[model samples]
Target: MTGVLTDGPASTRSPARFVAFGGAAAVLLTVVMVGSLDLHRLTTTAVGLRRTISEYALGPYRWVFDTAVVLLAAGSLAILAVLVRKGITRWASGGSLAFIAWSVGLTLVVVFPKHDWSVGPSMSGSIHRVASLVAFISLPIAALLLARPWLRDAVWGAHARRTFRFGLLSALSFTPILYAVLVNVLVGTSWWRVLPLGYIERLLVLVEVVSVLVVAVWAIAAAQPSYRRSNTSR
Candidate 1:
């Protein structure tokens, strides 16, 4: 908010505002890259929704996919830095650790491409699968934990409520994946074959990314002079 930038003392506000803006910009960059790729897919290629997002990496747009993922990881780290600096989250806290794990997992996902069934399973693919799992599972947990403390605060309560709900929604979106697993375990079929895995994954990602954005906005709010004074007084 402009108030955040203008109300605080210039010396303190300058650095905090810069970090906050940088974090937000990084997050926005991921959105831009992903959006452009998806737009191309939608209009030019008509890439089937049933195909997983990672499928992009197997095609000409591999660089775009990889860059988006790396940017997202970088954004997560920036968000964590802002939260830690503002004391909204501690470096050793569960929320902070979850965020760190999410960032690391995202980085690993970019480093290792998804398993190509035609090529058979490989170690890099296995690591990619595990990393994707960790990244998906970690972010909502981090958002929930981080939202908890601000749930009752007047200034941040609304934003916290939004983050908490989005986190829950993001968690719930994984139910189909769980169902796929259950079907695989019970019927001895491949897990990925049970559902529209691609669509479900995309939905899950959208909700999780939204949760992250909400928390980033909250961090920006926390950087405000009014919020800082209130927090200090408490």
Candidate 2:
């Protein structure tokens, strides 16, 4: 039941531990900010559930939205750094690339405001749409791929499974949207209006963020080279 699991050298682990802590804090802050904004919208503006989160970019609180998204990207980058340091994922690996895409997409979403379908599609709006899709889609894939290796580890197996499940949940949250799209196509109705798009999207974002937090916790817990849990006595 006892084994030496190599986390990393002390020097490397120190910096990685710092990065992981900061990353987790930033991500948590993002949740707070977004949640507050949504709460405010519900009480004051009474925005409909079908309205997208990106629509916040068009409001007076645009700066807050931008800052939250930037923080999310920055935090994701920090987690990625820790993952690389711990050898959980490589810089050239598919998981790393997908994570990078997710981070980059978040940044682009902040830079480019949401598309106003009423005003018709424009270049910036198109970019924003694509970026949103990339960010939403990539994070789940990254989580699944990154957590795949440690899924069988004696110590980290439970943590890995939790991360994988969050990823899967986030990915599966899109099914309703897909079904709505297919229905829209067949009936010539608006897909966005067919369901509570905002609520569904919020669920997806929450699950994906939880996945990142789970991975960050794993990285932080496993930062020490001597870190281990034993079930058997020596």
Best candidate per TM-score, number?
Answer: 1
Give the poorly placed runs of model 2, Cα more than 4 Å off: 1-13, 225-234
Estimate the TM-score of every prediction. 0.89, 0.88
Where's the lowest-lDDT run of ten residues in candidate 2? 225-234
Q: Rate the local accuracy (lDDT) of all candidates.
A: 0.80, 0.82
Alpha-carbon error at 76 in model 1, in Å?
Answer: 1.2
Per-residue alpha-carbon lDDT of candidate 1 for residues 1-234, written as tens digits (9 for 90 to 100): 111123544444546657776777877787888778777777776555777888888788899889888888887788778777776777898888998999999899888989888889889889999999999999989988887877876666787799889889988998899899899999988999999898899899888887888888877776655445324421
Q: In model 2, what is the error at residue 27, expressed in angstroms?
A: 0.4
